[model samples]
Target: MVDLRLERVCEEASKLFISKGYARTQINYIANAAGISVGSIYTLFTSKKAIFDFVLKCIIDGNYMGNNMALPIKESDFASLDGEILNVCKELSENFEKHILDGDDSYDFKQMISDVFDIISRYGVAFLIFQSNGSDSGVLYAYYVQFRKLFCENVEKYVYNFMEKGEIRRCEFPEHHARLILETLSWWGMHVKYDAFETNTGISQDVSKNVAMDALLHAYTI
Candidate 1:
């Protein structure tokens, strides 16, 4: 079972880090947002940076519970973590969009849409943090740009190839449609839950995937 305080801390920290940027988000803010005391926050994290590091690890590791995790990650652990973060993001960015390009016999538009949704749903929060806090996190921001460019290029490739094959509908500009599709997936997968101005649709992640994919398939499928 996930520790209640740890889960709350990670959730609130991720939200605050994305919305408020790393420098502005303090332990107290995370604690307040998490409905825990400032002292309680320290018990869970040695410092704000530790919390940030822990959040990044959880996002990448998908192990929010800290099951088998060392509690209260130390500053010593932060050493070399930035490189680790970049490496993980780099590998995923390099490989994820390739999931769409499995030759003609295996290509499936619905499956392609699922792959897009899965990647964004799984990794988009980290991307949002990288985007929103570019000033404080130049390294992550630069990496975020590369990650986005790589994914966009792959999407464009898939669109152009399938269009040439007469599978999915062809657009005047496959690049634009690639971005459009990405925006749709981003909104449903990540932004809807985080955008402060967005009205609550109470849509679960599974429902979001289905709705977004079905809509995209309707618009793009031949």
Candidate 2:
């Protein structure tokens, strides 16, 4: 029952935080949005920050591992390497377009990264604290962490494989390539589309993607 209430509150608060920036979203606003009283929220969360943190973690867990992460295709599993590579790229491109590039980020990328780390830590501690206690919290946390780890590891492997195959340029580091791909896409899509950056220069999404793709190919091929 507590978990259900937490999920509901977090979902509603997530909406509010995204629609209205975090600074402007007050506790009363969340309570109203959730169709609950201000006091009711306090029962579940000590403060509005607590609510925001939980909601932010949920968003990161959903976006990073749940959807955007890509897995590897084994050589034996695929009839042809070329076909498998293209398939992976297509899937990854679609996910990038939909989740990370679709809209203005509710929080900055750095904050999202930090929140993801926090959630991982919480999951780890939950296990240690509840081992042999058979608490449902421990079970749920462990399962969620494992599920997320699978996606994260798969995505990292996909990035490394693509680099190794010369599909993408050799990055200074493999992880750097993966992180930059995401960060560049998010910043380019949002700021370029909105002209929100200090610089007046803006690029279309197609051009932006092509530039990055071409630069990568050029760097890797020679």
Residue-wise lDDT of candidate 2 within 101-150, one digit each (tens)?
44433433233333333333333222222232223222333544454444
lDDT score, candidate 1, position 30 = 96
Task: Give candidate 1 regions above 4 Å deviation.
Answer: 69-71, 97-104
lDDT of each: 0.80, 0.46
Q: For each candidate, C-alpha RMSD in Å?
A: 2.1, 16.7
TM-score of each: 0.90, 0.32
lDDT of 1: 0.80
Task: List clashing residue pairs in candidate 1.
Answer: none
How far residue 172's Cα lies from its native spot in candidate 1, in Å, is 1.4
